[model samples]
Target: MITVDTVCALIAKKLGSKATDLTLGADTAFDSVGLSSLQIADIVYTIEDDAEVELDPSQAANVKTVGDLVELVETTRAAGAAA
Candidate 1:
């Protein structure tokens, strides 16, 4: 299972912001925090590069919320570890 905390932490790191500025629960949109389509692409590439895993394009689209992002990371990490 994924948690909002993990997703927010990664988002904060990617945005070069403090974790406190991001909360796990209640936040709905990623763009509100300044993440654009370009930035999201960058973030996805960075996640693949840093995490060393492949993401399904379809699955990536499912990552709209913080919980979804956390699940993506966890699933990607798990996939990487298995390989």
Candidate 2:
């Protein structure tokens, strides 16, 4: 059920004041929003924790956009449920 908005909210929460003026969307690149690698990792960790699913580190590393992170979360959640 993870969506782009969910990820965007997480990013915004992490960014705080930095996100006030940024327009977050599915296709928006992480770099475009001025996200650092550490920030991304923290967001991913939060997602994994919230979803109660551990995502593949390799796949997580490849996520570049909000949509990508959402998809990864959904996919990982689905796989965990299926198992």
Candidate 2: tens digits of C-alpha lDDT, residues 1-83: 67788889998998899899999999988878888899889999998888788999999999999899889988888888899
How does each model score on lDDT?
0.66, 0.89
Q: After superposition, which runs of candidate 1 have C-alpha atoms over 4 Å from their true positions?
A: 1-28, 79-83
Tens-digit lDDT track for model 1 on 1-83?
43565456566776784446655453545776767787777766666666566788889876776656666878888877888
Candidate 1 scores a C-alpha RMSD against the true structure in Å of 4.0
Angstrom error of the Cα, residue 9, model 1: value is 5.8
Badly placed stretches (over 4 Å) of model 2 are none
Root-mean-square deviation per candidate = 4.0, 1.1
Q: Candidate 1 lDDT (Cα, whole model)?
A: 0.66
TM-score of each: 0.58, 0.90
Candidate number with greatest lDDT: 2
